[model samples]
Target: MSMAPAVDAGLALLILGLGLWIIAARSNFAAVVGFMTYGLMLALVWVRLTAVDVAMTEAALGAGLTGVLLLGAAARLPAEAPGGGPGAGLRVLVAVLCVGVAAALAGVVLSLPEPAPSLAPLVAENLPPTGVKNPVTGVLLAHRAIDTLLETVVLIPALIGVWALAADRAWGARPGALTPRPSSSSLTLLAQVLPPFGILVGVHLVWAGADEPGGKFQGAAVLAAMWVLVVMAGLADLPKVTNRLMRYTLVLGPLVFVAIGLAGIWTAGAFLALPAGYAKPLIVLIEVVLTLSVALMLGLLLAGPPKERA
Candidate 1:
C-alpha cells in the first residue's frame, strides 16, 4: 500500500481509539477533550478523502466551534461526585457489545461497493444555467431547493425548542457566578473590536461563497458569532419577545425564501426557479436574507431571554 493510505489508516485508527477512550473514561473533562481530538482527526480524514469543503466544515463547526461550546458547557457542569454505580461486569459487557457493534459497522463499510459513474457530469452540465460553479451548492440551492427551504424552517423550531428548555432562567444569565461583569476594561476592548471584524469576515464569506466553499450557512454563523460577542459583552442587549423588529428579523429569511420560491413557481412553473436572465441576482438576494435570519436565530439562541434594560 502507498504511504498516503497508510497515513490515512493511522489517523482513522487514532480517531477511533480516542472516541473509545472517551466513552470508557470516567472523567467528563477528559471525554470532552477526546471528542475534540476526534473532531480534528475526522477533519484530517476528510482532507485525506479529498473533500476540502467537508474538511473545512468539520474543522470549523465540529472542532473549533463545538469544542468551545463543549468546554463552556463543561465549565458550567458540577464536578463528579464520589461513588458511581456501574459494576465491573456491566462495564465489561457494555464494552464488549460496543466493540462488537463497531466491528460490524466497520465490516459493512469495508464491504461497500467502490464508486461508479456519478451524477457529477449531469450537475456540471447544468452548472452554467444555474450560475453556481460548485455542484454541491447548485444541488443545494437549485436541484434540492425544497430541502434547503425546509431545513431553514426546521431551524426556527429547533431554536424554539432550546428556548423552551431555558425559559425559566434569566435571559441574560452569564455562564457562571464568576462570570466577569461586562464593563471590565478588557471586555470593553473585546466588545469594541470583535463585532466589526466579525461582520467584515461574515460579509466577505457570503460574497466569496459565489465562487468559493463558503455560503449562507457559514456566513450566517460568522455574523451570529458577532452578535453573540456583542450581546455577551453587554454592548448590545437582547430585545424582548414582544419586540416586533426582533421577531421580524428572526423569521425574515424563511419567509423571504418561501415567498420567492412560490413566485418562482408562478413565473417559471418550478419552485425556487429564478426568472430567466435574473438567476444570479435573485439567488444573491435570497442568500443575503437567509444570512440575516440565521444570524438573528443564532444570536437569540445565545442570548436566551430578553434582558431588562438598566
Candidate 2:
C-alpha cells in the first residue's frame, strides 16, 4: 500500500486531535499551548495550499505573537482547582457538536469551485499607473484610502479607551499583597535575540509590501512583538501618561493621515485623493507613521503606566 495518503491522513488526524485538545482542556495554560501548536500546523497547511503569504502571517502572528500574549496572560491566572464538576457525557456531546459544525464548514469550502474568475485583471491593468506592484496595497492605500483613514481613527480612540480603563485605581491595583519581583534572568538568550530578529523582519516586510502581499499591518505586528517583549521583560518601562512623546505617539497616525487627507481635498477636490504625482510617496510616508503609532499603542496596552521601576 502507498504510504503518501496514509501520511497525509495521519497529519490531518493529528491536527484535529490538537484542536479538540485545545477546546476540551481544563487548564487554561494547556489550552493556550495547544492552540499555539494548532496555529503552527495550520501554517503548514497553508503552505501546502501554496499560500506563502498567508502561511508567513500565520507563523508570525498566530504561532509566534499570539503564543507570547496568551502565555503571559495565562501566567497571571490562578491554578486550576481539583475535582472539576463536568461530566464525561456532557463533554462528549459538546465535542461532537463542535466537530459536526467544523466538518460542515470544511465540506462547504471543499465543494467550492477552483480558479474562480475575479476582478484581478482590472486591478492588474491599472497597478503600474498607481506605482504599486502589489494590488492589495494599491487597493488599501490608493483605491480605498478612506477606509484606511477611518481605521486609524478607530484605533486612536480605542487606545485612549484602554488607557482610561487602566487608569482605574481599583482595576490597576496589584493583585497580591506582595509585588512580584522582576527577574532579568527569567528571560533566556533566545528572548533577547528575538526582538532584533522581529525588527529586521518588520523592516523587510514594510519594504517588500510595495511589490508583495505583506504590508504596514503585518510590519506593525512584527514591530509590536519587539515592543511587547521589552515591556514584558521589564527592560523598558512604560512612560507616564504625562509624557508628551507618549501622547504624540498615540495620536500620530490619525493626525497625520487626516491632515494628508484634508490636504488632498484642497489639491484634488476629494478627501484622501493623492495628488497626481505623489501617491506612492504619500502612501509610504503614511505607512511609516502608522507602523510607529501601532507599535506604541500595543506597547501601552501590554504595559500600563510605569509604577516604581523594578
Candidate 3:
C-alpha cells in the first residue's frame, strides 16, 4: 500500500481548491494569495511529473517573482467601489469561455496516443555535442538556442514598456519602492540575513545548471528576489531610469547572445550553433550575462514606474 496515490490525490484537490479560490476571490489581495498558492501547487505537480526544471521555474517565477509583482500592484491600487462589479452577463460569458477551454484541453489530453511521441531519445543522442549533461540545458543552449535568444530579446521590450509608463517629468526618476515607508524591523532583519545566502544560491544555480536541473532563469529569479527583498527592506534604492550603467545592464545579455550567435554562423555554419568543443564555455557565458540582465529587469519591473527623482 503506497502513499504516493494518496499524496497525489491530496495535492490535486489542493490545487483545484486554490484555483477556485483565486477565481472567486472578492478582493485583489485574496486573489493574489490564492494565485501564488496555486502556482506553488502547480510546481509540485511538475515535480511529481519528474520535470524538475519546469518545477523550479514554476516555483521561482510563477509563484515567487510574479507574486511579489502582484502584491505590489494590489497594495498600490485603490479599493474597488461598491456596485462597480462586472455585469452578470459578462461573468456568465467568462465562465462559459473558461469551461469551453477546459473541455477542449481535456479532450486533447484524453485523445493522445497510448504512448505519446517524444523527441527525448533524439535529444539524448545528440546532446553530447552541446557539452552539457543536463538534457534541458543542452536543448535550450544548443539545439534550440535561437528560441532561447529570442526569449531573452523579448524581455527588453517588456521592460521598455514598463519604463514607458513613466510621465515625461518622471523620465529620469527612480522607480517607487516595493514596501511602504517606515519599514518594519523584522523585514529589515530578514532582508539583511537572507540576501547573502540567497545570492550565493542564485550563483550556484547558474554554475550548476550546465550539469543539473537549474539554469539562468531560476538563478536570475533568485537574484531578483534578493534585490526586491533589499529594496522593500529599505536597504537599497533602484537606479534612476536614465542611468547609463543601468540602461547598459538591461541590454547587455541580448547583445552578447546575438554576438555569439552571429559568430556561430562563421564558426559552425549556422546561427546560434556552437563551434566544435566550445559549446560549454559559450553557453556558460550566455547564462552569466543573461542572469544579470534578467535579474535587473525583474527587479526594475517590480520597482514599478518611476515615481520621483532619487
Q: Give the best candidate by TM-score.
A: 3
Give all candidates' CA lDDT scores: 0.74, 0.73, 0.89
lDDT of 1 at 45: 90
Better of 1 and 3 by TM-score: 3
- With candidate 2 superimposed using the best TM-score fit, by how many Å does residue 209's alpha carbon deviate from the native? 1.5
CA-RMSD of model 3? 1.7
Name the runs in model 3 displaced over 4 angstroms.
81-83
Model 1 CA deviation exceeding 4 Å by range: 1-7, 72-77, 80-105, 166-184, 305-310
Tens-place lDDT digits, model 2, residues 269-291: 88988887788888888888887
Candidate achieving the largest lDDT: 3
Q: Give candidate 2's TM-score.
A: 0.75
Question: Rank order by lDDT, top first?
Answer: 3, 1, 2
- The residue ranges of model 2 lying beyond 4 angstroms of the native Cα positions read 1-12, 80-104, 107-114, 150-153, 167-197, 266-270, 304-310
TM-score of each: 0.81, 0.75, 0.95
Q: Give the clashing pairs for model 1.
A: 171-305
